[model samples]
Target: MTVTFSLPPALEARTPAEPRDGVRLMVSRGTSVSHHRFTELPHLLDPGDLLVVNNSGTLPAALQTLDGVLVHVSTSQPDGSWLVELRDTDIARTGLRLRVPEGSLTLLRPFTSRLWVAAADVPGDRVSYLTRHGRAIRYSYTDRDWPIETYQNVYATVPGSAEMPSAGRPLTGAVLAALAGQGVLVAPITLHTGVASAEVDEPPYPEWFRIPPSTAGLISHVRASGGRVIAVGTTVVRALETGTGEGWTDLVISPDHPIRVVDGLLTGLHEPRASHLMMLTAVAGEDALRESYTEALREHYLWHEFGDVHLLLR
Candidate 1:
């Protein structure tokens, strides 16, 4: 289906001055919408409700050289190889070598357009190798070496993701305590998010994810007990959906593959034609998503990683 929604220049104000839960939260279920502080999340759900989170830790996927050009690496091949994409360069050499603190980086010419397949020789597993040789793959817009801690989810673990599962960012220590105090159940699953496709660009890359049987069992137990399964972000949705084998989901989310596991989804506003919007279409239907997105735009909701959050329930 062709998609359309409102885009407002004013919405940029919603960019989290602080990239945590600075996002405005909108909760929707049964034709109702309630705007509330993200901290108030626990109050909106019942005790024993299951909150499934993606524990895929973010990597310092961005690296720089003395020349000032930047590189963004996303997913890795299961065979311990990397499928990388490059940004901010017109130098299309057949092979490019990037110098890092501990090793030399090499790129195999354009996989497509501006993307290049790159890899580095390090001392251990890919994650460990990256830890020693790379910086968290960051966007030029950010312009800083945000410590690895800044890119990790509170409960993140495992190591294949290029970035944090951002929708869960608001569930801080205090919020976790609040959820615990309220008897809400929090379970973590791993789904490493590859490099985020730009709002204005749609790029293709391989999928990198790992979902444990125990996590699957936990989700099943929650649903079997009549507790709602709340997915924290699109990454979590992708992880849960991909792991469940509803079908081979190699691309974006869509209604053709309606979600079979998650009872609700908490995500951020996306831009026109953004691939993640396909996931929202799967969760809320193209019509409802357009309606909610229209409301978000008109309400001046922010966009991007540090923006407003959307909560939709089935």
Candidate 2:
């Protein structure tokens, strides 16, 4: 089925900061659209609604020129060396010139004008490296450090993501409290986002992921109890759907793929043609997804990680 989608200009990050949970939630069911706040998620669903959250923690994956040049490493090998995607090209490759304080450098390699590889010894764990050398990945619209914690949901645990599962970002301690107050059940699963790829093409590379059995059982229970399984982000939907067979995914979801689970989705507004939109199509179907997105564009819901949300209920 063909789905038409677009974003509203008003939703653009014309303003840098949006209050946590202050973004709008555009709820779509059939041809209808109901504007709501992200904080109102609990009240919008039934008591038995099962909320599935992605606990994949985010890394301050964007690096800058401290000594030389800044390259954002999206994926890392188990060996600690990383294949980072770089942005600037003014620096020489002979010596990695980054703005990072002295004694922070380890190894460096340039892959292309726009990408490179850099390594650091780092103290403690990988998280330390991120804290010391990296900043959160930002696109042209956003221009600030959103705090590693702001990029995360209250329930995030597993840490390996280059980006946050933003749809879940709207769910703060207050939102969770409200959900609990309303008797909604919340469960978590992990799916480390590798990198945010360009919408112009397919995914750039394979993303590694893992899901625990306890979360799987919670999903099964949610399904069996007639509680609508609501995925907090496209990452959660992808993790649950892809990992159900073996708790992992090397597969990409698209309209052609058949979905095995997830009845509802709470996700951010995506850029036009983003691979994520394809996954959303798989969940909401062509016609409805198209209508909802088209409406979002007309209504001016924001886009990107810090943007507003789109909740599609089937």
Top candidate, metric lDDT: 2
**The 10-residue segment with the lowest total lDDT in model 1:** 244-253
Error of 1 at 244 (Å): 5.1
Best by TM-score: 1
Decoy 2 TM-score against native:
0.84
Cα lDDT of model 1 by residue, 1-314, tens digit: 45676566666533233646555888766446668778788888888788888787887777665456666666766455566665655664757776655655578656656666666664566677667656865543453556777767778767778776778877788888888899888887776677764634563345655566777787888888889888898877776776653222365567787688888898877777777777777777766776677677666777766677889887
Those runs of model 2 whose alpha carbons end farther than 4 Å from true positions after fitting are: 1-10, 14-18, 65-67, 89-125, 197-200, 244-248
TM-score of every model versus the real structure: 0.86, 0.84
Candidate 1 Cα lDDT to native: 0.70
**Residue range 1-314, candidate 2, lDDT tens digits:** 35644454556663433567888889988667789988888899888788888887888887765555666667665666666654655544645634454334443775444445557544655566777767777666666556677677667887888888878877878889999889898888777776664424445355566666777788788789888889898877777777653333667788788888888899988777677778888887777887787777777778877788889887
